[model samples]
Target: MQVLRPQTSGNVDRVLDCHGNKVVLISRRRVFSLTAGCATFLAAPYLSLRQSRASDAIELPEVRGGGKIRIGLLWSLTGHLSVIEKPSRDVALYWIDEVNKSGGVGGYQIEPVIMDAKSDLKTYRSAIMTLMRDEHVLATFGGYLSVSRRAVMPLVTENRGVFYYPTCYEGRECWQHIVCTGPLPNQHSLDLIPYMVRNYGPSAYFVGSNYIWARESSRNAIEWLTQAGGQLLGEKYVPLGQDNFDVICKDIKNKRPDWIFSTVVSDSDIFFRKEYARQGLSSDRVPIASLTTSELEVKKLGVSYGEGHILSAPYFQSLGGATNAQFVDRFLGSRFGESGVTHFNMEETYLAFLYFKKSVERVLQENGHVPLTPENVRAFSGGLHLSNEESPEGEVHLDPDNLNSWLKPKIGRFNGLGQIELLWQSSEKVSPKPYLLYPERGVCLSDGLHLPNGTIVKAAS
Candidate 1:
């Protein structure tokens, strides 16, 4: 509710675009955006990541090696993924710009060999191969969908190449090659389902895109809900980018579940919510809860459509703290300009690079050159700790066991003003077991519990 209203800060120039919903104010060196919720202003003193030198534009290295650090940037910039996955790509570039501008990590300029997956499975595999075999990047970063992450992960492990994947994905499959920056089922779904059962209602419905991330997460959501004294009314999955949600929306209306949990992606995510609103449904009656939804999705869907929708993640733009305030402002100003918005997708990716920077610098300091191998990165992960104080998120504890970080969990609601209102957050970061080492289910069954398709594992005694 507390908004920093703009006073006579300086001589300001107002810019109006075709998108009339939001007004952007551009000043000499600062910019502020008037959004549907809170009016956001430039945080000021944003450190320039990339230099303006003519040489910085070239992505491929001049000589390939020559004592320079190279990072592989992979994300879907075009085709089906252009809407949801591009931010992951941009943030990777943002970090590369930051590292290179600061004279690089340990005296070597970092160069990004950027590749677009085009939202295709085969492209994801092929891109990683080129980054490792041809370009010989020190490490690779990017992967939005769990299916694509699953597809490309094996290739990275086969080559023993390090990958910094940033996406809130399904829990299971602890891969040796990936350092996951995204939250898992326990961090978001299990935590979210329990909260809803106690506070919102005990009956819920599940909807998702027809993919591994949505389907598997839905299974865990079912387990968590059942254990929490809640009942699952229904579960369904639609094809990716299936926009016509009339049939599903009609089905849900008839079902009359207390709340809805959605793992839908891309176009389906945006369209379903719009149709949800068009069906005369409001969050007060039945709010849509999601681990995949972010600020960007909300912005695109318009504030009115997602007014009371709930989102649970490690970070949010409205997360009040000195660190969060500083990062959010600089990121919005530098990356997207005054009119730009911040989302969890880019925030996690941004934080991942910052965490990886520490390891890269450590490797360079210990050995004269940055070793381009997964083993070298894994060796330094134990020594590396990304303090919650440094990031917009409270803290990130890097768990070397599964190569996934123990992230502090937070839940928020898109309130009346179209801004995220903090509902709940853990005081400390919780340890994660991606392969279901310690589940919320009381007894860790040696035989392992199985749902429709997914299995929940017990901890090792």
Candidate 2:
């Protein structure tokens, strides 16, 4: 058997000088010699060895045989808006699991690539780019905070990809690549403001988080209020995660408006409610009507703080209907145990994903296995109509131009025990008006109190 030998360079001068020309057999078969001349070449095996070790360290999902559909779920999983964003994330996963259980859209199992924005605009921008470029996700459904949505909208439009945003927002922006599943200002705030003023009173104070959604929504409210014979008491803006409401509370006390109309979002709402209670102000003394606080936030506020508070939204957990009941049952049973359904964003997320699935299915059925391109999704979405009993505002219709749903808004009063009961609902669908619908009118104001005598008046007036 011929043994493989290592190649080595012969240095006769060193050997002659050191060994004095002694006869010595050079084996030329050492490990160091074997690796010398081909050091770079030797690196290949070592590099591959390191890579193999790394491969063993990390476990990755195997790409399933046959067709695979990639969908991205980008949401604010951390930072200020995580309370709302986390539920959205969970609901997105729920929809993905549900779709896979039902044989998926167009016969391919969905590969969900979930990314966390961490409530940072830069992270949101980066996440969307990665989802589009690296993951090659066909479509994405996420974003609870309007600021984050606004950050990613330009990128999605430029890339010509589909981004379905599922939070209620100020409706001044519309894009070709974006589908907004949440109620717009017109669909929620515009109608709600007028109704509250008409039924309650016209003296209103506008309070909100210092963001595009709050600023724009508050502006819309001001317009509607002014139009409806309501007087504006004062306006204040707070940072989203702000803890200090002492100044704002003192201001509210001094103003003593019949009602405080607020667009405060996320944990800021909780702080406002707690501060309101701390100031010994009850809904009866000076009612606080908000556009953003929902069943989810109310739960977080607990019974004492949230009770008697009023909020306007398109849906609530207590909404009575077979569809809503089923949704509530499933959601609560799986997540919160037999009674877990609460957050408005959770329901909105469920609706968004279901709507997308319905549209995608329709397109596949009509177009015959045409892969889900953005254009195809848009076309399919144009003809989409979704109605369920769980929807507090009844049926929802999508607008072709804006790709936004026309849904009614419902008003609810928190009964202090974390239970929200519906008080009012739009009799008909409210269309999406991205621009200011009632810029001159502003928002309606009231005492925020529902009196037994059924008498309501504008506080400022």
Candidate 3:
């Protein structure tokens, strides 16, 4: 055997022979091979003597294969929900990068397959089908709007795939395949009305885009408002794609309620805000408390128009906590820059990935080296438990019926400085109740009674 010499001149730290083997010279006398395999084999019994200590340091669930785990991310990259979905897309990308950097999940690198839903129901359906059947993704995550999740829920269930829907919505439906990582209306809307009424008095205006979510959410708001001795000034419904808010603004101005309880979704929020600003109505004069306005929307709406707007949701960029701060720092630094982080779909997306990670780890621990297929993921996530600072809503437990987790809701306000400040929190953790009693009650009452058009209903009168 030929003696290997250091490649570098003078004092050398390492040596590489002609055969491309490596060795390290720590001092004038001490020398060792750079190959861990060689080291392990030479010191087998000695290594076995210290196996317990080494095992603790190298503790990880045994994964069957060493490869890349392909994850399909279906999000609204463009179109009506782009503003909300973009953050989620960014977060998913960030998670993929981070996981790869940290040696990946379960010793497998994550390969992300991204597709844009473009906010269209048909497009969402097609994207999920493609990711499931064509791409054969191990799992899928990211949905911002309730409509999109609703459209794909059946497909995901039928395919036995995993979907993490990150949006506050009506909680009447649940599926075993899809995991709702957002708050239900009761967690967000029910108690919020009481809080608003106690602080802002008992008169409110209801405005929303014409959709299943908005309609149902508004109905629940009406019930809570009525129950709290609050009077309904008036209610208006506008079509989803309608841009002109002139009529709605006029209605709001005429009603002049104490506060505007809005359930507007998508681009309607921008239109409503601009219109409200144009009407010379500041948030202080007639504050608009909403269920959907997140930090992402505030950034898009700009400081002038988004200032002082109140929102009730689980996550915010300014939430105080070590975990939240770290998450914000990492997420913003990687995707949106240090100062550009916003509260949007990203928080939910991040939580979804973490939930998936936990579920996968659980599967590995229990089943040992199972394939990370969609069915395996669904089975794993069925019993997944996720708790994090980003989830201000508290610990989210998977619901047995739908396999979705219930997120807590918090109240935040846009401070006109491109930041959202947390204001209030749910007094208690709200459990996931599948049936929306408040909205159902409102629907039943409205259908049963024949109230004349343009009639103002008073709860306390």
Best by TM-score: 1
Q: lDDT of candidate 2 vs native?
A: 0.67
Top lDDT prediction, candidate number: 1
The list of candidate 2 runs beyond 4 A from truth reads 1-66, 335-339, 389-393, 436-461
Residue 378 of candidate 1: its Cα lDDT?
Answer: 52
TM-score of 1: 0.79
Name the lDDT value of residue 132 in candidate 2.
71
Q: What would the per-residue lDDT of candidate 1 be over residues 185-291, giving only the tens digit for each residue?
A: 88888789999988889999899987677878988888899899999888888877688889888888999999999998886798999899899888999989989
Q: Return the clash pairs for model 1, or none.
A: 49-97, 388-394, 388-395
lDDT of 2 at 407: 82
Q: What is the lDDT for 385 in model 1?
A: 75
Candidate 2 vs. true structure, TM-score: 0.78
lDDT of 2 by residue, 1-461 (tens): 01133233451111221213111112111122111222332223223223223222322112233577777777765566777777777776656655677887667777666676666655666677667765667788888766667656666655567788877888654356677777877777766777767766778878888777778788788888888888998999987677789998998899888788888877778888889899888888777787678777766767777777787888787888788777766766553232244666777777777777777778777877755676567567864678765353358877765577778778888885677888888888777766556333332211222223555322111
lDDT-best of 1 and 2 = 1
Candidate 3 lDDT tens digits, 236-350? 8876655788878878888788888988877878888888888788888888898887766676778767787788887777877777788777777763342366564567677
